[model samples]
Target: MIDSHIHADTRPFEDFEAMAVSGIREAVTCAHDPLEMLSSDVVMAHFRRILKVDPHRAALNGLKLHTALGVHPRAIPHDYMKVLEELPELLSDPSVVAVGEIGLDSGSETEMNVFIEQLRIADETDRRVIVHTPRSGKEEITPLIADLLSQHIDERRAVIEHVNMDVIPLLIESDFMLGLTVQPEKLTPQEAVQILKEYGTDRFVLNSDMSSSPSDPLSVPRTVHRMRISGFGEGDIMRVSEKNIRKFLKIKN
Candidate 1:
C-alpha cells in the first residue's frame, strides 16, 4: 500500500518500520513548515530533507519514500516568491512526484496568489498537485478553491486533500480526485470506509497526512483492514489504498 500524503520528516524512524510492518510499501512526504518563522532558506532545507533525507530513512526501514515540494499556505514566508522562483528546478528532481501541500488556509490574498502560482507551475511542468483544504472554514473555502483550480489547471492533475463529508460534494462530480485523510483530527477509519462505500472507490484515495501533530502512522493499513472486515472487495480496497494514488502521481511502481 502507499500513503498518498504524509510528513515523514516529522515522524520518528520507528514509525516507518511500523508502517512497513503494517503493509505500507511506499509513501509521499510533502513539504510543510516546521518552524515558527519560516524563510526561503528554511523552506529549501525542508524540501531537500523530504527529497533527499527522508527517502534514505524510509528505505532503511523497508519502505520507499517519494516526496512533494511546495510552499504550504500556512507556512509561507515573507520572501515566499524567492521559494517560488526556485521551485521549478527543485521539482525536476526524480524523487519529487508532485507540487503540493499547497492551497488556501486563511483565504488571504497572498495565499490565493501563491496557490495560483503553484498551480500554474504544476500545470506548466506537467506534475500532479495535492491541494490542501483546511479543517476550519472548509465549507466556505472549498468552493473558492474549486473555482481557482478550475481556472488554473486540469482537474485530472490534482487531488483535494483532507476532505470531509461536507467538502466531498463540492468536488465529487469534478475530475479532481478526493483525498480522505485518516487522523485524530480528520476522519476516523470507519468514516473513511463509509465514504468509500457510499461514493465508491473510483475517485477516492486514502492518506494518513501524518506529521508531528497527533496522527496514526498506520492509518492507511488500519483502514485497509477496516475495509476488509466491512466486506469491501479486494479491487475496491486496492483502488483506495494504492492504485488511485499511483495513477494520480503517475508512479511507475
Candidate 2:
C-alpha cells in the first residue's frame, strides 16, 4: 500500500522499517523548513536523502520513496522567498512529486504569500501541489486558500491535506483532490472508514501524516483492514488508499 503523505524524513529509522513490515510500499515524504534549533541545510539534506533513495532504512526496508519540496507554512522563515527561489531547481528533479505541505497555518499574510508563491511555482513547473490546512479554523481559512489557489493553481493538480469533517465539504466544492490523514488526535482509522462509507471513494486519498507525534505510522494499513472488515470490498479500499492517489500524482503502482 502507499501512504500518500508522510514526513518520513523526520521519523526514526525503526519507524520506517516497521512501516515497511506493516505493508507500506511507498510514501510521499515532504520537507519542512528547519526549526530554530536546526539549520536549513539539515532540512534540505533530509529531502535530498530521500531523493537520492538513500540505501538507508527506506531502501533497506523495501520501501520506495518519493518527495515533495517546500517550506511548511508553519515553518516559514524570515527569508521565505529564498526557499521559494530554490524550489524550481528541486522540482526539476524527477524524484520530487509535488510542491507541498504549503498553505495556511494562522492565516497570516506571510504564510499566505508563501502559499501563493509556491502555487505559482507549481503551476509554472506543471508539478502537483499538496496544500496544508489548519486543524482549527479550517472553515475560515479553507475559503481563503481555495480563492488563492483558484487564481494561481490548476485545481486538478493540487491535493489539500489534513482535512476533517467540517472542511471536507469545502474541499469537495473545489475540483482539487482531498486527503484524510489517519493519525492520533486527528482523524482516526475508524473515522476514515466511516468517511469512506459516507463519501464513497471518488477523489479521496488516505495518509498517515506520521510525524514526531505518537501517531501510528501503520494507520493506513490498519484503516484498510478496518475498511475490509466493515464490508468495504477490496475495490473500495483500493480506490481510497491507492488508486485515488496514483491518479492524482499520475504514478504507477
Candidate 3:
C-alpha cells in the first residue's frame, strides 16, 4: 500500500521501518515548514532534503518515497518570492510528484495570493497538487479553495486534503480527489471507512498526513484493516489505499 501524504522529514526514522512492515511500500512526503522562523533558504533546504536526503532514508527501511514541493501557507516566509522563483527548477526533479502542502490557513490575503500562485505553477508545469485545508475554519475556507481551484487549475490535477465531514459535501461532486487523512486530529479509521461506505470509492484516497504533530504513521494500513473488517471488498480497499493515488499522481510504479 501507499501512504498518499506524509511529512517524512518530521517523523522519527524508526517509523519508516514500522510503516514498511505494516504494508506501506511507497509514500509521498509533502513539504512543510515546521519552524516559526521561516526563510527562502530554510524552505529550499527543506525541499532539498525531501528531494535528495529523505528518499535514501526511506529506501534504507524498504520504502519508496516521492515528494511534493511548495510553500505551505502557514510557513510562508518574508522572502517568499525567492522561494517561488526557485520552485520551478526544484519541481523538475524526478522525485517530485506534486506541488503541495499548499493552501489557505489564516484566510489572509497573503496566504490566498501564495496559494493561487502555486496553483498557477502546478498548472504551467502540469504537476499534480496536494492542497491543505485548515482544521479550524474549513467550513468557510474550503469553498474559497474550491472557487480558486476552478480558476487556477484543473480539478483532476489536485487533491483537496485533510478533509472532514463539514467540507465533504462541498467537494463530493467536484472532479478533484478528496484526501481522507487518518490522524488524531482528523478522521479515525472507522470514520474514514464509513465515509467510503457512504460516498463510494470512486474518487477518494487514504493518507496518514503524518508529521511533527501527534500522528499515526501506520494510519493508512490501519484504515485498510478497518475497511477489510467493515466488509469492504478487495477492489474497494485497493482503490483507497493505492490505486486512486497512483492514478491521481500518474505514478507509474
Candidate 4:
C-alpha cells in the first residue's frame, strides 16, 4: 500500500521506518515550509540547503521515503525573489522526485510571488509538480497552473492537491489531476459522499496530506478505506492511490 504524501514531523522517520519495515512499499516525504506566510521569522526557519535534509539517509533503511522539494507558500518572505533564484540547485538533488506542495494561496501577496516563482522553477528544472491550494472562492489558481504546466508540456506535468468543489471544472479542462485528501470527521461521511457523487471518479486522486493530524483514521491508508466505503471500485481506488501518484512523481512504486 502507498500513502501519497508523508511528512517526517507528526510521524517521524523512525516511525516511518517501522511502518516500511512492516510491509509498505514506498512513500514520499515533504516538509512544511509554507511560503505564503513566510514572514521574516519563517524565512529564517527554512533549511536554505534543503537538499541536505538527511545525507546519511538512503531508501534502503526502511520504506524508502523519497522527497518532493519546494519552498511552500507560507514560507515566502519579502526577499523570496532571492530564494526562488536559488531553487534550481536545491531541486537538482538526487533525492528530489518532484517539485511540490507548492502553489498559490489566496492568503497574501508574498504567497503569490512565491507561487509564480515556483511555477518558473518547475519549468526550469524540468520536473513534475505537486500543487497545494487552499479552499477559497478563488479557484482560478488551479487553472493558472494548468496553463503554466501546459506551456512546458514536454518537460513538466502537474497535480493540484487538496481540492474542493471549485476545482472540478479545472480538473476536466486540464490534463492535470485533482487530489482529494481524507478527512472523515471534518466532512461527515454524507458530505463526502455527496462530493464524490457530484464529481465522478475519473482523474480524482487521493492523498492523506498527513501533517499534525495523527488520528489513525486520518492516515493515508485510512483515506483509501473511506473512499472504498463511498463506493469507489478497486480499479478506481487503485488509480488514485497508485497510478496517478506514480505518473505525477515519475517513479515506479
Lowest lDDT sum, 10 consecutive residues, model 3, at 33-42
Candidate 4: which stretches are off by over 4 Å? Answer: 13-24, 34-61, 136-156, 184-202, 213-218, 227-232
- Please provide, for model 4 over 1-253, each residue's C-alpha lDDT reduced to its tens digit, 9 standing for 90 to 100: 5556655444544555555554445666664653344454454344332334432242444555567767676556667666666668867777787777777666466665566677777777787777777655447666665554566543227777776666666566666777666553233334444566676656666555656554332345555566778787877767766776777777764
lDDT computed for candidate 3: 0.92
The lDDT, on a scale of 0 to 1, for candidate 1 is 0.92
Given candidate 4, what's the lDDT at residue 223?
A: 50
Clashing pairs in 2: none
Q: Deviation in angstroms for 70 in model 1? A: 0.3
Structural similarity to truth (TM-score) of each candidate: 0.98, 0.93, 0.98, 0.75
- Tens digit of lDDT per residue, candidate 1, span 44-126? 88877888888999999999998899999998988999999999998899999999889998899999999999999999899
Please provide, for model 2 over 1-253, each residue's C-alpha lDDT reduced to its tens digit, 9 standing for 90 to 100. 8899988766877888888898878888886543541445554655576567442568777888788888787776666666677789989887788888788878998888888888888988989998888878888998898888889977888898888888787777678888999998889888988888887888789999887766788999999999988999888888888888888887776
Model 2, position 179, has a per-residue lDDT of 90
Evaluation by TM-score, superior candidate among 3 and 4: 3
